[model samples]
Target: MKVNVDLRLKDIPGQLVAALEPISKYDGNIRGVVHHHDDRVGGRITVNVIFEVRSEQSLDKILSTWKEGEVDIAKIDAFFETYPIQYLLVGSITSKELESITKGLEAMENVASIEIRYTGTANSSSRAALVTGKASKKETLTTLESFFKQRADKHNYMLIRGLD
Candidate 1:
């Protein structure tokens, strides 16, 4: 079975290896590991690890090993990537705030560009943010939403996620 395990870990060094080491021991073959740095969500570093393995038992063991030391499974899903994922952020967005959001994504690895639409107050939450990330479609979607959610909550914005 192919399982997608999403884990949130600390931003400090070596946490990535710590999370991956256990998976191999449990006969989990990593398909893709999307490691990202999220400034929001209490600044917890997030990783969307995609693995192909057999049996729920092996997955459970790996999960148990990683369920501590500030490591958490945000989601465990069965995922497949066709291509890249796209997101739209529509709300009252200031240029400066949007710039910060872009910078935050840039600070993480694989975030390519943030092309914003600048809708200019079409509604109560009527601004647009177009972000492109070099992450697996599912991981990119998850990571982007998590970041947007924190920024929106802090600054009162609404985000919508879908295909471009």
Candidate 2:
């Protein structure tokens, strides 16, 4: 079974991973994780973790682990299937930079996965990419904007259909 969890934890180092450790401890493999920031008002951190579980009843252990860790479980959801969206990431290409780009995307809400390759362009040239995600077009676009802005590269976003 695939389940989603919304957890609130202290915005501290290793706290996110600490809260997530129970997923593996409970025999669940994390399929995705998104940590969004809402700093304008309260300094609360929201972490959305998606995992595959062996038994639906195993959620108890997961919930208990969260409480022990002092993490707040805002919500949990089980779904039969996921909604997918695709987007284009076209910008400067570099094997070294892709890691940062990929990590940035993963730390966002609704971004399930990222696939990166390169286009044969010069150093200051651009490349084409395919990013698959489990979010709405709007959500994905917002994630893209945040991820793409970290670097001083020219990245363009073109929403292919079915992302809505």
Question: Which candidate has the highest lDDT of all?
Answer: 1
Against the hidden true structure, what lDDT does model 1 obtain?
Answer: 0.71
Cα lDDT tens digits, model 2, 1-164, are: 67998887778799888988888989988999987776212456888899987666677788888887788878889764445645555556565556666777677775655565556553545566555656523446655654555453443333233334
The C-alpha TM-scores of every prediction are 0.45, 0.45
The residue ranges of model 1 lying beyond 4 angstroms of the native Cα positions read 68-70, 79-164
Q: What is the lDDT of residue 69 in candidate 2?
A: 74
Model 2 — which ten-residue stretch has the worst lDDT? Answer: 154-163
Q: lDDT (CA) for every model shown? A: 0.71, 0.67
